[model samples]
Target chain A: MILDGKALSNQLDVNMKAEVAELKATGLSPKLVVIIVGHDPASQIYVHNKHRKAIKLGIESIIERREADFTEAELLQLIDQYNCDDSVHGILVQLPLPKHIDEGKIIRAIDVHKDVDGFSPESVGKLFNNSHEHYPVSCTPKGIMTMLSHYHIDPKGQHAVIVGDSNIVGRPMGALLLNAGATVTYTHILTENLSAHTKTADILIVATGVAHLIKAADIKPGATVIDVGMDRDENGKLVGDVDYDHAKDVAGAITPVPGGVGPMTITTLMQQTIELAKVADHRTLQPVR
Target chain B: MILDGKALSNQLDVNMKAEVAELKATGLSPKLVVIIVGHDPASQIYVHNKHRKAIKLGIESIIERREADFTEAELLQLIDQYNCDDSVHGILVQLPLPKHIDEGKIIRAIDVHKDVDGFSPESVGKLFNNSHEHYPVSCTPKGIMTMLSHYHIDPKGQHAVIVGDSNIVGRPMGALLLNAGATVTYTHILTENLSAHTKTADILIVATGVAHLIKAADIKPGATVIDVGMDRDENGKLVGDVDYDHAKDVAGAITPVPGGVGPMTITTLMQQTIELAKVADHRTLQPVR
Candidate 1:
């Protein structure tokens, strides 16, 4: 069975339109401010999609544009502006900031409460520590969890194997799965025997950016496979890390590239932005201690 | 073979004595401040051992004792004083803090720079994120890693299983093993079919605090087991989570309860304090920007 992220994302977006309107009726409008540096075509497309989704959901959207030569200090200043804005509930700095700016430094500077992207160390820390207070989770993994629940796939007690250990996907995904009561095994570039680990997975998540890295032979029968990779085949067509044609035959369920994890990422971002807005509004209602 | 944490900890203490003296020669002496509230007998013994180890390593030690009824505000105030004091290089709040005082609240209050215990979320975040900057790791996990190296057990490309997910030991232990290039699996109380997960380990670390919870059948043959449990059996004899007598026959190497992870925890705390002091001094030497 194909896990249709696009169909699910569309359904979520439709439901959110009403929720956003209800919030607006109460005079609390959710707002997201996205900062993008350079005209990196890929990042531009991503930023545009985020903006479109926010507008569709009745969210107030603002995009701050900067040249490729934007100084690290200037970007930090822009983030500070959004952090202090009362109307802005969520802030996202599109990645691959010009080489001159330190990405880690920029991420550390964002207020955890306003970090919609969930790339900040504090947000990552909260996710791993199982913090009591609610904080934004990284969109890709958060979306994956939502999809699993939507499909009625419970990860509890399942053997989850994640290929790749990138901070953005593999590492956080491992933490999330472990938190959900799955025994997680992480295989990366340094892993000695990749197949030895993959064949053991009850739920396999691949995000190595290597097209067709996983195949039918590597997957266990009835395993649920989630492909987070967005790569190109020799024919210049989009492909995921898993060989979908073969894996689909063996996998109980699988997500395909382009139409799979892609749409869900933007959808999760829109969802979290509204959640941040609702949380902020709730805080305002509480009498000052 | 028994992995002798006691002998290794003593050797580390000797080396640290000379290291601390070398730093002291530079006129920046290392100091550790331990705060204990309500003197639970177990906490009292642990605090005393820490103070003893600090003095032996040529590091200054200060123990702040508070009554059982110490208010959370008063505890925070005490932490603030130490945070500002230039002489205090490390601050440790012994665990099982009075029920009235929120332990997490007090932990977050400690400055990360002085958090030798590594209970703060920031320290933990740095560990999992593999941050380049220096930060203290939770002592028990740090000690286990050191023990692994001393025994020449490289976890790289190995399957490491951790049988606990507590914030202090199990979670950080998994992060450390994963960072060391191991495909790590985490099993906790919530884990179903626990033995199924345990039997696949190349290197197993058990810290579940359940006496004799793991038996020979649960261990993979020739696996290196690091038991972190300190539980008393029916006869009131100290034992570990692993049934050592039975496990030693099947396991390639293992640690005994009394002389294993227990001593190394305090030893790592002392070592980290000295390291923290050196890092602070290096920062001071940097030319003013």
Candidate 2:
């Protein structure tokens, strides 16, 4: 069974549109501060998608484009500015900001209430805590759970092995899997005998940006494979970390590239944005959807 | 090879003395804040040991005893007061506070820097994030690692299962084990076939708070068990989560009750206090020793 995230995203968009209408009727449009540093075409396309999605949902999207030379202090000051501003309901800092700026510090600076990206240390901490009410979860992991539900696959009694140890994907993914009652093992570069564990996962998620890194040999028959990587194969075509053709034959279900997890991330962002906007008042202490 | 935390705690105390002296020579003293609610005899003893140990290390330890009538706001104000005080290098809030107070809120209120107890959400978050610098680690898990190393037990490639899921013990223990390259599984009330998982662990740590909950029949041969629970048995005497008589004969190594993970908690508190004091001027964070 394919986990059609595009369909799930559409359903989420429907719910968000209704929520946004309710907010708009009250004369308060959801305003999200999207900060992008430097000019990468890929990032520009992502920002455009997010901006259009927000506008389509009746939420006001505030695009703040900073020059490549913007200092880390100045970026932090901007975060402080949004934290104090009553109108700003959510904040999203586009990743791969210039290498000089400390991404961790920048993410931590965004007030947890405004941290719709769920990159803030507090949000991470809140998610790590058993009670997930205080912070918004990272979008992609939340989307993964949403995607899993659509497939009617429960992680309970399952072993999930996540490839890669990224703060954005792998680490939060581990917590997300654990939250759903799955036994999770997070592996990185230093981990030994990687396949020995990967083949045992009832659910395997490959996020390492290595094209075709996982083959049929690395999977267990009837296992569920999730490809979160967007990389090009030797033939210069888009391929996932898993060798989709061979891996899928041995797998029970798989999420393919292009229309799979990719569409879910941005849609999750918009859904979280409207959720943040709906509960803007007393946002600090309140729960985000 | 046994992971003797009590011996390591003594060694750590010895090391803390020299570091405290170095800080004193620079006109700074490591100060740890200890806040306890009501008069639980056990908490009193724990606080006393911490204070005495701090004094031995040439650091200053301050105890704030509040009556059970204290409001949550009042407790938060106290935490805020210490959070702003640069003199207080470490803050330790003794757990088992009155049920009326919001423990999570109070723990979050303590500035992450001064959170020596490492019970704060940010500390836990920083821990889960690969190589986090600021959030102080939960002390017991940190201490357990030291004990493991002292006994030359490395968890690399080991299947380590943690029973119980307390924020203070089991949860953080799982994160630390994951960080150390162990295949980690955390189980609580919901986990099925508990013995099936427990019996496979090459290294097992039980913090279920149920006296003698883990039996020899449930542990793998030659496994290393670290008991972090202290409970009164039917005999009205304190016993650990592991049934020592049976486990000791079957397991390759173990840390005994009273001198095991129990004493290491306060010992780690003092060690972190000294380390925090030494780094007061320079904001460089210390690695978990």
Candidate 3:
């Protein structure tokens, strides 16, 4: 069975749009401010897509763009301005900032409450510790969880193998699975006998950005495969970490490259923006003693 | 080969003691404050042991005992007092606090700077992210890493299986090993065929708190096993999660229950206390803008 993320994302959006209207009716506008430094072409496209999504969902989206030569101090000051604005519910700084800027420093500058991208150390800590409290996580991993739940694929008592060690997707993805009761194995570039470990997984998540790193032979038959890779093939076609065309024949369920994880990520981001706004509103509604 | 955590801890302490003296000579006295609420017998003994270890190393130790009826607000106030104190380098609130006090709230109340036990979300987040910044981690897992380093058990490219999912030990242990370039698998009570996972481990860490949970048959020959469980067997004798008597023959190296992880934990706590003191002192010494 193919896990059609595009269809699920569209399905989820209908409800989200209605929810946003209700929130606005209650005098709370769900607002997201995405700050992008530099003129990276890919980042421009990503920022545009997020803006379009937010507009469709009836949430306020602001794209703050800076030149490639923007000073780190200037970027931090801009973030601080939005952070102090109670009107903004979510703050996202596009990653891979200019060479002069420190990515970690920029990430740490965002308020944890408005940390829409959930890259802050505090949010990451809460996710890894499986805190019972509501906390935002990296959009990709949290989106994957939503996909899994929609498909009724429970990770309990399963062996989930994460084929990357990235802070963005693989690490948090494994933590989410582990919290969901899956015995999770994390393998990275330095891992030895990678196939030996991959073949044991009941649920395999490949986010290595290595095209065709996992062939059909590397997969366990009947395993649920979620591919999080966006790599260019020799022919300039987009491909996933797994050889999906062949692996899908052996795997019980799978997600395709373009339509699978991509749409869900944007959808999850919009959902999180609205959720954060509601949480902010709730906090204000609480009566002071 | 026995990992000999007790001997290693004593060996490390000689250097730590001298380091403490050197710091004191430089006009900085490392101070640790431990707060324990209610009289849980095990917690009392653990706190006492920590206090004793700190004093022996020439570091200042203060124990704050609270009655069972102490309110959560009072506990938070106490933590805030220590958090604001410049003289105090570390603040440890003993775990398994009275049911009335919320553990998470109290942990967050501790100044991340003085989070000696490393239970704060910020510290935990740093551990998982493998941050380059200096941060303390849960002592038991940190101690295991120290022992592994001393015994030359490099986890790089090795398959390390964690047989429990406790936040304090198993989760952080896996993250530490992952940061060290190991392929780490985390298994817990819900894991299917736990032995199947354990047998594949080049290094196995068991902390299920279930006596004799792992036997020789569950181990792979020549695998290094670290047992973190402190359990009481049917005969009222202290034992670990692993059946060490027989499993030791199959294992290449292992840590014994009493003389192993326990001693190293206290030693690591002391080491971290001093480290936090130095960091605090360094922050204060930085030139003002």
Candidate 4:
């Protein structure tokens, strides 16, 4: 069975539309501010998509556009302005900023409550702590959890193998799966004999940008595979980390590249933005226990 | 061979003592302020041991003892005082506070830099992220890592199994071991068949407070076992989660209850305190990359 992120995302959007209407009825509108520095083609596409979706979902979309030479201090000043703006509930800064700016410093500057991207150390810390408050999680991992739930694949008691150690996806995903009661094993580039771990996974999530790092043989017989990779293959075509053609034949459920995790990532950003707005309105967001 | 925490901690103390002397010679002292509320016998014993060891290593030890009826607001005030005091290098609030005080709230109040116990969510997050900069790790797990190194037990390429999921030990231990290049699996109460995972471990760490939960049959032959359990048996004698008398016969090496992990926890606290002070002086603590 294919984990149809596009279809599931559409269903989620329907619910969000209702939520936004309810919030509006209560005189509260969800707001998001996305800051993108420079004209990186990929970053431009992402920023455009986010802004478009925000408007479609009835969220007030504000984009702070800057040139390649934006100073670190200048970017931080913009973040501070948004942080103090009660009207702004979600603040997202597109990644891969110019070399002149320290991305980590800029990320830390975003107020934790308004950090929609969930890249700050405080937000990351909260994710790992699985604290009592609801904080934003990385979109990719949050989306993957949605996919798992959509397919009715319970992580509890499963042997989960993650093929990356990145903070944005693999690391946080590992924490989430562990919290869900799966005995998770993390295998990174440094891992010796990666297949030894991969072969044992009941659920395999691969996020290393290395194209087709996992093939059919690396997957368990009927494992659930969530491919988080978005890379170009030898033919200049977008491909995921898994050999989907062969892997889908062997795996029980899989998510396709272009339509799989991509759509859901943006969808979660919008969902979490609405959730953040609700919390900002009532000052109460229950922890996801 | 016995993995002797007693002797290893003694060697660690010797080095820490010299480090403290060097800092003191420079007119700086590594100081720790331990705040204890109520007179729980166990809590008192832990506090007494920590302050005693702090003095032995020339670290300034200050104990703020409070009555059982101490309010949460008062504890928060005390934490605020330590957070601002330039002379205080580390602050520790003894656990199991009176029911009126929220332990989590008090822990979060401690300055992450001064969190000697490493119980704060920020500190725990840093530990899991395996961040470049040094932050205190929970003492018991840190001691276990020290023990592994003392015995030349490299976690790289090993299968490490943790048999509990408490925030302090099991969760962080899995992260530490994974960062060390091991394939780590965490088994908790929710684990379907506990022995199924335990039987495959090359390095097993058991921290469940349940006595003799893991016996000889549960261990893999020649596996290294580290028991973090501090429970009393029916005979009213201190025992560990592993059935030591039986497990020792099958295991290659193991830590004994009273003399093993206990002393090392305190020793690691003192070592981290001196390291924290060094950073305070030069402001140049390198990341653990």
Estimated TM-score per prediction?
0.95, 0.91, 0.97, 0.95
* Candidate 1 lDDT tens digits, A230-250: 989999998999999999999
Clash pairs for candidate 4: B132-B287
TM-scores of chain B alone in all candidate structures, in the order given: 0.97, 0.95, 0.97, 0.97
Q: Which sequence of candidate numbers ranks them by DockQ, best first?
A: 3, 1, 4, 2
Give the better candidate number (1 or 3) by TM-score. 3
Candidates sorted by TM-score, descending order?
Answer: 3, 1, 4, 2
Complex DockQ per candidate? 0.63, 0.49, 0.82, 0.55
State the lDDT of candidate 4 residue by residue for B50-128, as single tens digits. 9999999999999999999999999999899999998999999988889889887898899988988878766776777
Query: Model 3: per-residue lDDT, tens digit, A1-289?
Result: 9999999999999999998898888898999999998888889999999999999999999999889999999999999999999999999999889999988888999999999888888988888889987788899998999999999999999999999999999999999999899999999999988999999999999999999999999999999999999999999999999899999999999999989998999999998898789788774331100
Off-target runs (Cα >4 Å) in candidate 1 are A283-289, B283-289
Local distance difference test, per candidate? 0.89, 0.81, 0.92, 0.88
CA displacement after TM-score superposition, residue B270 of candidate 1 (Å): 0.7
The DockQ for candidate 3, computed on C-alphas, is 0.82
TM-score of the A-chain for all models: 0.96, 0.93, 0.97, 0.97
Q: Can you write out model 3's per-residue Cα lDDT over B1-289, one digit (the tens) per residue?
A: 9999999999999999998998999899999999998899999999999999999999999999999999999999998888889999999999998888899999999999999888888888888888877888999999999999899999999999999999999999999999999999999999999999999999999999999999999999999999999999999999999999999999999999989999999999998899899899883332100
Runs in model 3 lying further than 4 Å from the true structure: A283-289, B283-289
Q: TM-score winner among the candidates?
A: 3
True contacts kept of 2: 0.40
How far residue A240's Cα lies from its native spot in candidate 3, in Å, is 1.0
Worst 10 residues of 2 chain A by lDDT: A280-289
Angstrom error of the Cα, residue A96, model 3: value is: 1.0
Model 3 iRMS (Å) reads 0.6
